[model samples]
Target: MMGGSAYENVGKKWDLGVEEQEWFHGLLPRVEAERLLIEDGDFLIDDDNSILEMVNQYCLSGRPWLDNSDIVLKNPIFREKWLLQNDDIILDRKLGKGYFGDVNKGIYKPMGNAVAVKTCKETFTQEQTKTLLTEGRILKQYAHPNIVRLIGIAAQRQPVLIVMEFVEGGDLLNHLKKQQKPFTSQQLIKMCDDIASGMAYLESKNCVHKELAARNCLVGNGLVVKVSDFGLSRDKVVHTMSDKNKPIPWKWSAPEVLLNGK
Candidate 1:
């Protein structure tokens, strides 16, 4: 937790007025905010003023702001706190590649644990970088055993990396297709249940996974399945597509989403 002196310095550095400080305190209870502030090794209270302004506005409106649009737009601060030093991660082997990035198996020096490091293409446009950061922000907010957990992001360097828990069993589709032995109906039912439970949790949080398929799900030891990929997920029920929106994979997308482009 931040010391009283450090808290006072933050208020002074941001030039927060009495009411603004009170509102900021209310938005993130002092204890919780302080704990996060102290835990983050690269904490920089001066990096983003827009986040402070957004929090102040939400506090004035007397509404919860953590999951709101305003907060989402100004999520750099959240991403900053979770930023991992690139030097600390050692990339081992390529896991897979996607349109935006490639995933690699790696070792996180700090925790001495295996992790997946997803690196964006070096030629990514500014908008693509923002989208990648947005995914990092979303993962930071949602933490569940059934969902792939984001460890941190290595954004200070090129080909920005998103580190996450590594699932040894790999994706579900391949796991099913390459079964060494025939599985019982009960095992298949349990896998379905795991997917449904994860989706149910997302629904309760007012989040849409957008992409839900066997290929996007990962399996762990003891056949634990976890939902992965949040590049297209949204916190709201309806998402507005841009003119440059990529064509949906019809096989994995909902009929209405494909028809109406929601």
Candidate 2:
């Protein structure tokens, strides 16, 4: 579900603090302009203001802006070759192509904070665009340490980048196969229990994680488990794109999403 763009959130309601409301009221007319804007970590109403801050701090090294001509993105000192750019550091790896975009390991900078960034393609159908936006919002809301936290997002017409905490230990599928050592029943039980603990948190928030395969989980040293990838996660949003325009990503999604909850 796509909530109305922050642009359209003016008349409905706001979860903003009182001070935030004052800031919002200062630009009442701008919000009503029907244009979407996010600047300086704070959203703006109009696009005419060109000096928007690079709030998407988690960019490819330094190349943060899109450059279609060069087939790269340029920031201050870096030039990300598109594939190398992710919210988390790509660490110069080639993961694979994904439904919404591609997957790559990215450097989460400042040391001790490696992250994996999900880079999505820019060209999207009306439905795909809606899915992308909603997917990002849900990612930002998940607060558990076991869940990959969304750092930030960079959006353009064709390429969108989602920065998230990178799990260095890799996912469960690779770990399971790479380490092929048989685990005792107790170990498996502990693994399952850890997963349930994480899911239980998501459930307490009235959320459901429909996709729970071995591949989605990540295991670090000391057997710490964290879940990654939520491309199919959904919840109620104020429906920005009409149902007629909403398109669902079904490759990894089940039949229910394709049918829009029947």
Q: Of the candidates shown, which would achieve the greatest TM-score relative to the real structure?
A: 1
lDDT of 1 by residue, 1-262 (tens): 2233222333342474332332222122233345555432223232223376554344334344456433211111232346676667899999998657888999999999999988888899867876776677668877788899999877655667889999999999999999999889989888888888888887788777767889899999889899998776766653455754677767776454566566
- CA lDDT of each candidate? 0.68, 0.52
lDDT of prediction 2: 0.52
Cα-based TM-score, every candidate: 0.69, 0.58
In model 1, which regions exceed 4 Å deviation?
1-81, 237-239
What lDDT score is found at residue 159 in candidate 2? Answer: 54
The sequence of per-residue lDDT tens digits that candidate 2 reaches over residues 1-262 is: 1223332333322343222221221112232223323232233322223221232221223332355432222221111122122222434475656678777776655444555666666566656655665676667777886776677554422355666776777788888889768877987787788788887777676555546667888887677788777764555343322454546544444444455542
Which residue runs does candidate 2 get wrong by more than 4 Å?
Answer: 1-91, 108-113, 156-158, 236-262
Q: How far is 156's C-alpha from truth in model 1 (Å)? A: 1.4
